[model samples]
Target: MTITIDGLSIKKKEDFYANIKTELNVPEYFGNNLDALYDILTEHPDRLQIKFLHYDRMCAQLGVPFCQKLLKVLQDADILTIINQH
Candidate 1:
């Protein structure tokens, strides 16, 4: 299934992870951090198609460093993450 993240609603790093965790149905044991995110994305059994809607807002809200980290994790993970600028 394709999971869409509404970037405009994410105001902080916490929100970013929380949104992902909720939408992706991430496990309770999940660490809710970038490292954990990377691990989960790489290890999860399901093939996830992640779509980031209004991605520019996310970058603006979370800042470039956080955005870079998130994107890097997604890029390196063995899953496809699409940035939907619209």
Candidate 2:
């Protein structure tokens, strides 16, 4: 499955997590945190392709440090294909 997230729409951390939870159809019990995201994506049953548009803008909004952490989690997830478009 493929999911596209527009970085411009993400105003805060919660927006990003909300987008992931909704798009990925994670259970209600899912924790909205980087560790939980990594656990879920790594164990996901289906191959997932996640595309981030305006990645640079997201970094500008969320700060480079946080985006770097988020990117690390996504990169470490074996079952996911992450694409970033600036």
Candidate 3:
């Protein structure tokens, strides 16, 4: 499955988690944090392709440090991921 996240739509950390949770259809018990995100992405049984649109905008909105951390988690995940700045 493919999940696309529009960086422009993410104004805060919560927006990022919410978008991921909703798109991934994670359990209601899912924790809205970076660790939880990594757990879910790594443990997912099916192959997934995650697309990040306007990545620079996302970094600007979430701050480079946080976005770097988030990117680390995503990059470490077993699933496929694509990041786009345009």
Candidate closest to the true structure, highest TM-score? 3
Query: Residue 52 CA error for candidate 2 (Å)?
Result: 0.3
The list of candidate 1 runs beyond 4 A from truth reads none
| Residue 20, model 3: Cα distance from true site in angstroms | 0.7
List, residue by residue over 2-45, the lDDT tens digit for candidate 3.
Answer: 99999999999999989988998999989988899999988867
User: In candidate 3, residue 21 scores what lDDT?
Assistant: 84
Tell me each candidate's TM-score.
Answer: 0.89, 0.88, 0.91
TM-score (C-alpha) between model 3 and the true structure: 0.91
Model 1 score (lDDT): 0.85
The candidate with the higher TM-score, 1 or 3, is 3
- Cα lDDT, all candidates: 0.85, 0.85, 0.89
Model 1, position 66: C-alpha lDDT score: 85
The stretch of ten residues in a row with the least summed lDDT in candidate 2 is 77-86
Give the per-residue lDDT of model 1 (tens digit) for 1-86: 78898888989888988888888778988896889999888787688888999999989998999888887888888668888897
Using lDDT as the measure, the top candidate is 3
The clash count for each model shown is: 0, 0, 0
